[model samples]
Target: MKKKFKILIADRNPHVREFLRREMAGPGYRVRLAENGREVLKFIYGDEFVDLLILDPDLPDTDAPALLRKLQNRLPYIPVVLHTFIADLGHCPDIFNVVAVVEKGGSSVERLKTVVYEILAKDRAKEKIRNNMQSAGQKKAAPATGGKDEQK
Candidate 1:
């Protein structure tokens, strides 16, 4: 059986969180919610692995840029989709790691859905390549002694 990808949605508004959680929930993805930066951090540090993050830059507890930096430090490989009112993130170099910057406006939810699908597709491609490389490595390492006793 295939495992579902886990996504963390971090927004200050409960409605927004619920909306996203509902939107992102489906057969291929598992959605998690966080109302603030602290909860987001806790979720990240938890045992459950997160595959993606949908973050709102207007978080009440902490600066979004700082949170992005912290997330990068902790889980650099996880892709982030920054959903915010402020679309001009060109000044924030730290947010360069974000795979998508979605403006919070009419039709934004649809846009977010599209971007999530695109990002998850890319992630799956990368995972496949990584797994192939690992399997190849294991195959090469398996014959260290030729699986037989040395010649007499």
Candidate 2:
């Protein structure tokens, strides 16, 4: 069976967190919510693996830029979708892990969902290719079993 992708949604607004959770959970993703920067850090650094993050740079009680930098350093493999207001986009730190910046609006959830799906699909494709390459390399590295040297 395929593993369900786990997503962490971090926003300062309780309503936004819950709304995103409901939206993402409907499609069978394991959704986790964080209402502040501390909670976001806890979830990301915890034992549970997260496949993606939907982050609002205005998260309370922490420096947003610092958090973004830290996440980029520690979890570069996990893609982050910045869910923030359009005006605040300029203040956001440019980080490698941020795959998309989604403006928050009444109709933005659909776009967020589409972005998440595309990112995960791309990741899956890359993983498949890596696995295939590894298998091929292993087959090539294996010694021939029925050669003249084996008979001797």
Best by TM-score: 2
lDDT by residue (1-152, candidate 2, tens digit) is: 55688999999999889889888885448998888899888876788879999999888897877888778778879999999997886666565578899899989999999999999988888988998999999999998898777865
**RMSD to native, candidate 2:** 1.8
Per-residue lDDT tens digits for candidate 1, residues 26-140, read 9899999889989988976778879999988777788778888888888889999988877445545578469888999888999999999999988888888999999999998
- Candidate 2 error regions (>4 Å): 26-28
Clashes of 1: 0
Alpha carbon lDDT at 109, candidate 1: 94
